[model samples]
Target: MNTAAYFAQIYREPDPFQYRQRWYEARKRALTLACLPRQRYRNAWELGCSNGVLSAALAERCDALLGTDLSAAALADAASSTAAFANVRFEQAHHPQDWPTGQFDLIVVSEVGYYLSAPDLSEMATRLRTSLADDGLLLACHWVHPFAEALSSAAEVHEALAGGLVEAFTYRDADLVMQGWGVSPTSVAACEGLR
Candidate 1:
């Protein structure tokens, strides 16, 4: 489906699969957040933040958090849900080519990577590598189940990111898979220290 049509459907009816409503999704989000290397972060950027449910959770751990989506309708819902958090902002944005200008201490790629083609995913990997701060952390989570229109699989996205980064750890089960990357050795050491 075209991006416009695809997003239009989502705008019309938000998919609970990506939201924090279901037990499966809630569990995945919790696991994603728990794997972070730090207790708190100065800034975080979450891409494809559908309805901001996880964004709300992330705001508690970040001094400043920006959640972006290609669909304005999604941002509307996000803005409403995150209104109480002064440190959180929502915007309509596309990835890789339109990545935000500043560095991010933490970046979340929840269910966003599969929307890109393989080459675009590679470009995104490069952009992510450049955008992360020296001691920053990157968390990636995606559903392992296949959709016919998806350009790549969850494993492929993780592989692309792994190729560009040093993998800190990973979590996987029947429903979803997550990968963590630390930008520097210090962050890796810190993650190891917790074990």
Candidate 2:
């Protein structure tokens, strides 16, 4: 099945991925938010924003945020879930193809890269290299376990995205890998001139 159709069917349940009820998801959200080096971003984009759970949290820190999903159902849920946040909006996009134009200070790809084939993953990296702001941070989080839907493994996904970028931080667990990459990677303490 194509990614869009697959997601649309699953989203018929309106939270099929259980963003609100799943412990793993809750923990992942917390970890992703905490790992961000900056407290505020001028603009941010979240690819494959399942239900806007993360986007809602991100809205608190970004002047503007865009969340893209493959399915209208998911986007609708995302829009509703994030209705209170004026800075947040949901759009439907086909990934690497429908990617938004203009540079972003923050671009997050969470659990979405593995769905693309190796070539497409490479293309995504290329886009990230150019679409990202010079001082931008690209954060990626993915599941470590292999699944039937995965076109690439977590290692391949992260490796593909990290190309030509500097790794700022990384967190690994038995089930997931979360990391951030950027230009001129620096330490938080260093950003604060502690060193």
Candidate 3:
């Protein structure tokens, strides 16, 4: 399937993934937020920020956030959903080929990685390493179940991206797998000087 066309068709409805209505999505977002070792970040990037529901939540913890999507329709939805946040912006990007210029203190990859080919994912992992700041963190979340469009499994995606980084945290359920890596991995309590 044409990736852009597929997502464009999916975005025919405003909430294609039911991000706003689904309890699972909401809880995943909450877990993603809670898993961050730092309370706030200077700069953040969210890949595949379809409709920007998570971007809106991430904006609260970031001084500046860039949300990128491959589909124009998805970017439009993301822009509208995140309009209230002055700190958040949306862009059209096809990753592992298209990348932002600056480094980010926080990078989020959710539900998008499985769509990339293994070679592309490998390249993306390299780019992610370069784009991440010295004290940055990378978080990824994906549905565990296989789907027609997925070129790779969640485990494969995570393995490809997590290479050379220190793992910070992880969460797994029957439906999803979420993991984070950092330049210098530290626990939340350690970040808060509790340990």
Candidate 4:
């Protein structure tokens, strides 16, 4: 199946990923947010923001936020899900091919990298160098356990990110791997002159 059809089927359910109702999803969002070195970003972009569960929370931390998804149905859900946030907007885009123009201070690829094949993910990683600002942060979170829909492993996805990217932070559990990267790196305390 193509990207749109696959996601179309997935979005048929009211909450296919159980992001709103699952402790795992909720806790994952908290962990993702907690891992950010900076409290606020000038501009943030999330790739494959299905249903916008995380996007809603990110909106609170970003001056301007863009959430991209492949399916119109999913974008509709995302739009409504983040409707209260005037700073947030939803756009339809296919990955790698339609990456938005301009740089972003915060770029998130959570749960979406493994869906791409290794070559595609590699291309994405390459594009990220140019897409991200010099002082920007790029984060990715993915399930460590293999699933049928996963075309690549979490390791392969993160490995792609490691090329030319400085690791800013890392978190690993048996179930998930989360990390943040940048060109020039510093700890949260360092960014705040606490160190």
For each candidate, give its TM-score against the true structure: 0.92, 0.97, 0.97, 0.97
Which lDDT tens digits does candidate 2 get at residues 104-187?
999999989999988888998899879899889999999999999999999999999898899989999999999899977758
Q: After superposition, how far is residue 75 of candidate 2 from its true place, in Å?
A: 0.6
Whole-model lDDT, model 1: 0.84
User: Per-prediction RMSD in angstroms?
Assistant: 2.2, 0.9, 1.0, 1.0
For model 2, the stretches where C-alpha displacement exceeds 4 angstroms are: none
- After TM-score superposition, the amount by which residue 142's alpha carbon in candidate 3 deviates from its true location, in angstroms, is 0.6
Instruction: Write one digit per residue (lDDT tens) for candidate 4, span 1-195.
Output: 376788888888887989999999999999999998899999999998999999999999999999998888878988999999999998898888888989999999988888887788889999987899988999999999998888999999999987898999999999999999999875888878889
For all candidates in order, the CA lDDT equals: 0.84, 0.91, 0.92, 0.91
Please name the candidate that would achieve the greatest lDDT relative to the true structure.
3
Per model, state how many residue pairs clash: 0, 0, 0, 0
Error of 1 at 99 (Å): 1.5
Which ranges in model 1 have alpha carbons more than 4 Å from their true place? 14-20, 186-195
**Greater-lDDT candidate between 1 and 4:** 4
For model 3, how does the per-residue alpha-carbon lDDT over 1-195 read when each residue is reduced to its tens digit? 578788878888888889999999999999999888889999999999998999999999999999999988888888888888999988899988899999999999999899998899999999999999989999999999998899999999999989999998989999999999988867777767789
On residues 98-192, what C-alpha lDDT tens digit does candidate 1 reach at each position? 77879999999999898889998999988888888888888899889999878889999988887757787889888788988866553535566
